[model samples]
Target: MAPRHHEAIIVGAGFAGIGAAIQLKRMGIEDFVILEREDDLGGTWYVNHYPGLAVDVPTTTYSYFFEPNPNWSRLFSTGTEIKQYADDVADKYDVRRHIRFNTDVEGAHWDEEAALWRVALGGGQQLSTRFLFTATGFLSQPHTPDIPGIGDFEGTVVHTTDWADDFVADGRRIAIIGTGATAVQLIPELARTAADLTVYQRTPIWVVPKVDLKFGPRIRTLFDRIPLTQRAVRAVTDAIYAFMVDTAVLKHRYFRRFNIAAADLAKLHRFASIRDPELRRKLTPDYDFGCKRPTFSNSYYRTFTKPHVHLQADGIERVEPDGIVNADGSKTVIDTLVLATGFDLWEANFPAIEVIGREGRNLGKWWRETRFQAYQGVSMPYFPNYLSLASPYAFLGLNFFNTMEYQMHLMDRLFGEVRRRNATTFEVTEQANARYLDRMTEALGDSLFTLGNCASARSYYFNPAGEATLLRPMTTRRAVTEASQFPLSDYTFA
Candidate 1:
């Protein structure tokens, strides 16, 4: 069949994808298309509609650096508000027209002869492009635990990523599994309405108290009228968070007091909120805060104080027809079962859409047989003219917006190199990819993820080899600078 073609093809219309498109337009490259699997613009936000769903990061730091939202209703935005921001940005930049919604990519193969990516779409459609950018985020894929009787759960089962607007839980006996970020955000909301809410937590997580406030009209008016004033607030917020990440989360030594203090604060909050000593112990994390993803919630600890809410530490052994069997043989009848269990981070590397690199180098096979590593966490050694955003070890701390910015900077540079050389293809050399991974691996060996009291957090942060793979192991500032200084000579373009 004759296939459609473009100068550039991007997958996933989230922050990474939208940023890449905007940058490409700015560089006078408009022959591009953004393919989104969902029928909407927002990527993660559009998918998740769970109760109490809101961004953990502050609005000041979460927004795009170029398009700061001076009109955020709250300090941290709800999922609905955040999704609207994404839609607004797309409309403002006129990138929405380039987006083909509900177009799912099934596979992508690098065409050596044509120097183009042969992208196979769902429903027997196909496209070819000179450059293929995969912005399919790491957290897009949902993961339910491998429990024996989960399928036979005769009650209402809901995954956080697939929550429906019409699904109701009020006055129902709810059993929610997992105590990660998603679960943490959900418990407080469920406690308020559910007849009885039992949270089956396998592992406890460290929690920092969240301080949220409404952005009053006075501040909103000032921010919208005077852009510089809002810029100052955002800058100050950025500086404060950057320091917290560098001193506390990044390093395992040297004023390790910061990590300890943060943990102590969490413990104190738990102590103050939870009256029962045994219950507090069950809620406390044995590992350090930064081992797993650190979570912020003002009402999470306070929720347990309610008589309607229950916390189970032994976790769910199996699911009965209408109840969850705890490891200790206790069973709680649940009318509704919600799996707030988050996404499959590792599986995201394989791409729901398959990718075949040069010389029949299958992307999935390479990741499984060899380790998952990328040159500066963007380009692989074998994938010419391909850029993978939000790649392994690419997440800079917890600030996704900043991480995407750093990645886009690298992408902008690589696109520039492609234009300058008038090259048909570009990929990182094997040696360069290896060397960059080696340095990062060494530095990661000493970070809080490996050490710092997190021996058995069972965190998604570590891969099967017990090495940290999800985080970049550097401060946000440094990660951006490193991406900016990428040696153009490192890539082979021809």
Candidate 2:
């Protein structure tokens, strides 16, 4: 028998899930259950434990707005530290008492008769709720490269998303598969310890030098002692970062010059740092800077200069008994394999969970039919009272947490409306959703995805139609402002 009833059911315990729970609690919505698959919290942070795993965005900018951690150890924080911070947030909010840890949400279907969502758990426990919130963020799942011989590889293999602490690569011959953002930050760190490192690169990446600096003792003490000073400092830093990616990336004079400087800096760093021109060429990318998520690495370029490190630009053909074989028939032997390939950002990493909305409509099929359109990336038309925290176009290159906070704010308003109207459900109208979807698609088409410059084969930013879905092309402020205004007029009340 399913544990039968609650006012709300939240699926994940990550940044987004926790955000929703905290906001709901503040709004006096206490009858809610946060279902976490793992025994602990920190959704993405808990999973990705690879070497040199850390936040790419600056520490001052990437945290919660309401409660900023003034005591971060570095400008760019590591995975462990961030995870601990998430755990801290959970503790501070007393959110753990409401969370059902180690409980995996199997599936959820809307029961038309009761007008509630029936949520199934792995342990055969069930919960019924008036609304379902999928805070299981878009990037929670690990995507493995579909190479033929992946299973046959005899050496120790690991994915950056599921890295185990017990695993070691200290003196082992390691071959890293993907050269995405994770690879950029980690390769350099691995070089300092690995016996021999070979990076199999399918495409070249535009490498930019990270100007990471540690805060002085005075600044740290000041920020810790005076909270307002920390908030002011964080605000200033956030604005500067927003300008760089949001406005600066689009500007002709400033951003273009910035790209040239980036390339030149890479060349200078490589020239002074790496002696091998061929290796440098393989490491350098041809696309415009910020064409993809620009990685932060001060030592990645320097890593190539190491005697034991090898960068193979040739495409991976297949996995041999010892290591990877390139398209050009060249092979490098390694005892350990690390896949730095990122997650399926579009699928929202909750594919295993079956979500059946009105008339038994599956969420996946609905997305597929509509090309992944959601009104402000939150509530879909048929799926009433459903909100995805970091859904389509909710991603801002500046800092993901700010976007998450904004979405949480939007959810707050929606829940408020639900309470005010004495309504059990509020579904987005199809006409409004379609109109917004068209506008968003037009906006994206004018942006970088269709700009003929981005060169990756496929990324999680797109829908099933190969159209970009995860990001809105507008500025961060505009996106947030637009998301904040929910058209109660567009929602039908019951």
> Best by lDDT, which number?
1
Clashing pairs in 1: none
> What would the per-residue lDDT of candidate 2 be over residues 333-375, giving only the tens digit for each residue?
8899999888876554524377888898888777766567678
**lDDT (CA) for every model shown?**
0.85, 0.77
Q: Model 2: how large is the Cα RMSD against the reference?
A: 2.3
> Poorest 10 consecutive residues of model 2 by lDDT?
246-255
**Model 2: CA > 4 A from native:** 248-272, 347-352
Write model 1 residue lDDT over 1-494, tens digit each, in one string.
Answer: 67989999999998888988988898788999999999997889889888899998889889889898987988888988999999889999989999999998888999998888999999989999999999987788889889979999898998999987787778999998889998889889888889999988888988988888799999999899998988998888788788877777677776478888889999998888888999998998888877888788989999988999988888678888898899999899988999888877776544556899999898877877788787787888779989888676787877789878898788778878888888878989998899988988888766777568778698887766666877888887787888888788888989
Assess every candidate by TM-score: 0.97, 0.93
Query: Worst lDDT window (10 residues) for model 1?
Result: 344-353
lDDT of 2: 0.77
